[model samples]
Target: MNLFGKFATVGGATLLSRVFGFGREMMMASALGVGPVADAFNLAFRFPNLFRRLFAEGAFNAAFIPLFARSLESDGEGGAKRFASEIFSTLFVVLTTLTVLAMIFMPTLVRTIIAPGLAVCVDTVDTGRQAISCETRFDLTVTLSRIMFPYLACMSLMAMVSGILNAFRRFFAAAVAPTLLNIILIAVLLYAHWVGADTVTIGHLMSWGVLAAGVSQLALVVAAMRLAGFSVALGVPRWTQNLKRLLILAGPAALIGGITQINLFVGQAIASFKPGAVSILQYADRPYQLPLGMVGVAIGVVLLPELARALKAGHLREAQHTQNRSLEFALFLTLPAAVALFLIPEPIIRVIYERGAFDPTATPAVASVLGLYALGLPAFVLIKVFSPGFFAREDTKTPMRATLVSAVANTVLSFVLFQFYAEQGIALATTLAGWLNAGLLFLGLWRRGLWEIDRALVKRGALVLLASLAMGALLLVELHLLSDWLVPAAGLHRQLAALAFLVASAMAVYFACTVLFGAVDRSMLMKLAKGRRGRAKAAE
Candidate 1:
């Protein structure tokens, strides 16, 4: 399949996953809200999730996919399969050992790394009343982290399998697997509500649910691998030459990934000092993540292998074309999303999360943070687009160095901003850090002559931004006109109707402006569609 076809397959599945994830977060808000339990749970979950990104999704894939694709190209199917097996065995052993160690030292991890603020007791009153009134529970955080830490092991292995599948252009399974996680979590929340379980019990069950979902995700991807006519067997760890080279490359990539996650970790850790700050930020983050996952992640996952294959075959022009189009595609989707988030954050957050345990008072703070995060959305997506320029060429150290600078900037900025803006300041710090990272990546690529923005891409990006601004202007007016109907107390049906109308209007305006302004190339889209159809027919 062509690049656009692969993107469609992956993006569509990711869109589904994001929708389910939205539902999960909505339920979580009603169940836990921005309460002590919610804060603790978010803290606990962030620990393992951070490592999952570090090992499985970010660094491991960046390092492994290129090498795996090269093995497939140079040594044929058998060589690639053997290589995958060895990597899988090694990753399984390492992740299992790490998970065990993390579980054993969960307290220290929480005290030093996750939530140091929870160590001191405070006479804070429960404002939200979603859970028992208490200070942040350090012991509870540790317990939940230990329960959920195993998820990192399961998901790391699953990510390795996903990288193998992605290398083969089988994007559907890997993209769809995350939806299963949201589904399981939603189901657990529903069950917990049905049984009238307290927030703490619900939290514990949800942590276990994360582990269960990991197993299911791993099983699904393994089934997909099998269906693709590849059997990846588990074996004793081997220190083959290729494996050693992969480790060497992955070391820097892992640091890069860790640095990238540290941006969020810093924000979360600082937010933990205030009761419900973590959950509030989490709720606000969910909306922006939808666009990020749909556009940024889809491009990142599909672009890497495409660029790797092209570069390996000495097809520099094709690789550059792939990179430029990926950027165009990312901006086409992300610009409008960022505009919407920045323009209508309060309405969006209120409509989605300000019900049940999530009180009205929390909406403004979350909305403010969402707006700040909107400023960074483009940078985040750009990072995903540009980083592959380095990774596809097997130069992980450059991005790692860039990330170190960004990470340090984020830490310092968060600390400075927290004293004034509180959680919003932390959110702003993250945004500034994202731009710094993206800028550094762009400069590095330019210096190396690896990527260049052509005239067409620049024109299209400019038009996309203009169209997004136009859409945002329209949304602001429409929202103001529908202010009365948009309130949460106006009844769910009415509020939803107003929100739906505003969203549809914004989308319509954005698409019309882009098409009329020639931002989107009609013929190119038609050609891609036609190519996809022809390929489907040939396969049939």
Candidate 2:
């Protein structure tokens, strides 16, 4: 598919999933609010999510894509299926074992890794600007974490299956798999509320819902992969060149490329002590994930195959060009998003999540973290897009080394920043780490002279950045003008209108200014705007 069509196909599916997720969060905020119960739910879910990214999206994709593409290229459909079957079978056993271990060690694990959740139990709970006993916070976290812990097993399996499906060129079911998760969560929340489930029991109900979402997501993706003519079996393991290759690549990929997520886990740990910190991070993560999911994941998935093919054919120039173009697209798209989030995240969060359990105080706090996250949005996307450059060339060590640097930087920054800014500081630290990672990657590639942005790309990038800044300024003006109409100081109606105005004005201003200044290439913009579609950056 052309870049635009592929983005639309993948991004559209992602957008649907994110919107459903937003709905789920909305329901959650209404029911849970920003309290200990909410923290428990967030804490419980993140463990599974952390592992899910490790095994499914970030780490799994890093290893799976190159191997899948290679299998398909050299061995045809039959070869690819056999390879997938072998890996799938082994993965099942591994994940099953891992799940049991996690459950058995859940408490100890939480204490060690997510210790803040445990510590919160010893501290006071912030119950709407008031303090409650530490036992309440700790007990809530412990119970909820236990209930939702099984989701790790379910989602890990789901991610493995999704990788297989993507290899089979079946993107839709896997792409939409997350929608089921969000949908299930939404339904559970709505039902629980409608039936007037006791407030005390809502945390327990939500934990079960988290588990349900995991099972549904895993089962759906596995079924789709099976229907796509691939199956996994837990057969006796044997050494294979492909398996060995995957392991060799995967180890470093996970170590290096997956550092960002590791830092997130770190952030989670650090944020645990602060009241409502975990929930605030989760709320902010929603919008931050939108662009990351759409562009970053899509590019990582698509470009690796393309680059692997080119590299396998000894087409270095083609691979290099692809990297450059994808980087440009990522930078072009994400820069503006960063600016927008930094400037007007309050209205965005207010419109999307400021009802039910999510209150006004929660809005700006969440928005503040979102802004912090936005600072690294472009880098986050770029890392995913550019990573295959190293991976496709069978060089994972450099990225791995860079990742180690970033992980340390992230950890150090978290400790230092948390002392000052609390929850948002942890987020900002993560953003700083990401920018460092991206800078290092680009510098590495440049040192090897593998990535080059010619004068055209440089000029184009400048135009995009300049125009984006113009758009940002326009938003600053319109936001103040539309403040009363957007959220005002009170009432739902005014808040709703104010939000609509903020969105419309921002869109009008950004598009108008960028289009006028020729930020996006005019010809390309028209083609893309008209839905003709073209290659856009993978990471953004």
Candidate 3:
């Protein structure tokens, strides 16, 4: 299928997952809120999620998909399957060993790296009216981390299978796996609520749910791989030449992932010192992630495979065109989202999370963080777009070096900022670091002559920015006019109505401005749709 079609398939599935993820977060906010249990759970969950991103989503795919795609292109089905089996066996062994080791040392991991602040006793004032003790939170985080670490192993293997499927141009199943995770977590939340479980108990159940979700997600992609006419079976580990090359690429990719995740770990560790700070940051982060996951990740997933295939077949022009259009498409969606998040964060956070245990007083802090995060949204999406230019060419070292700079910036800034601005300062540091990372990646791609921006793309990007600014202006006006209607005192129905109107109005203004400015046209969209169908037919 065409790039746009593949993106739609992946983005649509991701959108569904993000929607359900919102529901899951809403339930979590109600059930746990910004309490000690919530803080502990977020920290615990971060352990496995950190590795999952490092191994499964980030490094493994960066190393695996391109090679897997090239194998299919040159060596055909048998060669591709053999390569996949070797990688799968090696990945399974490595991840399993890592998970076991991590689980065994969960307490040391938590104490040393994850959330050392949990060790100290805090005064009641520091506890912020939450009765759960710091020591209790510390113990619970260790236990929950142990419970969830196995998920990393499951998901890493699952990611390899996903890479195989993506190589085969099968995006649906892998795209939908995350939705299953949200679904399972939501179910566990509901069941816990029904059972009248305590917050700590609910947290424990949720961690277990993560492991279960991993298994379910792995089973799903495995089934998808089989259905796509590839059988990837478990075998003893082997150190073949292909495996050596994969390891060579994967080492830097993994380091890059590690560096990037360290930024998050630093932010969270700093946030953990204050009660409810981690949960507050998490709540603020979820809304912006909707667009990021839907657009950025979808573009990254589809773009990498597409670029790999093009470059493999010696189609440099095709690769460059794909990169440009992907960037344009990403900016077209991401700019408006950044504007909305920056301008109306309070209303968005209040509407989604203010109910239940999420305190009204916490709204301002969460909203501020959300707005700061929005400032970096475009940078985040651009990273997704541009990094593929290097990864597809097996140039992982450049991004790793760039990530190291950003990581150091993030780590130093996070500490420096937290001393003054607290959680919001850490959020700001993350935003600035993201922009730095994107800039470095872009410069590297341009220097290597891999990325070229045409006049049309620049004009469209300028128009998108202008349209987004216009939308932001409209949103400020709407929020001012309906300010009272967005508050908790306005009741849920009124708040929902005002939010809906604001979103609809913003979308209308942005789209209208885009058309007027000649950024995008109906004919272009129709042609894209037609091209998608033609490509799909050709694939069949």
Best by lDDT: 1
Question: In candidate 2, how many Å is residue 338 off?
Answer: 1.0
Better of 1 and 3 by lDDT: 1
Candidate 3 segments exceeding 4 Å error: 55-58, 124-130, 255-262, 528-540
Task: Give the per-residue lDDT of model 2 (tens digit) for 1-540.
Answer: 565455557667777888888788777877777887777777777777777666655466677777887778889888887887777677677767877777777777777786555654556655553455767666666677777877777776676677777665566776777788888888888888889885457778878888888888888887887777777666876678878888888888766656667888899888887778888988888888888877776676667767777888998887777777777777777888889888888888887777765777788899899989998999888888768778777889898888889999999999999999999899999999998998898888889977877765787678878877887888888877776666635677777777666657766776776667666667876676555332344333
TM-score of 2: 0.92
Q: Which sequence of candidate numbers ranks them by lDDT, best first?
A: 1, 3, 2
Indicate whether candidate 1 or candidate 2 has the larger TM-score.
1
Note the Cα lDDT for every prediction shown.
0.87, 0.77, 0.85
Q: Give the Cα-based TM-score of candidate 1 against the true structure.
A: 0.95
Q: Give the lDDT of residue 204 in candidate 2.
A: 82
Segments in model 1 whose C-alpha atoms lie over 4 Å from true places = 55-58, 124-136, 257-260, 528-540
RMSD of each: 2.2, 3.9, 2.7
Model 1 per-residue lDDT at 236:
100
Colliding pairs, model 1: none
TM-score of each: 0.95, 0.92, 0.95
In TM-score terms, candidate 3 sits at 0.95
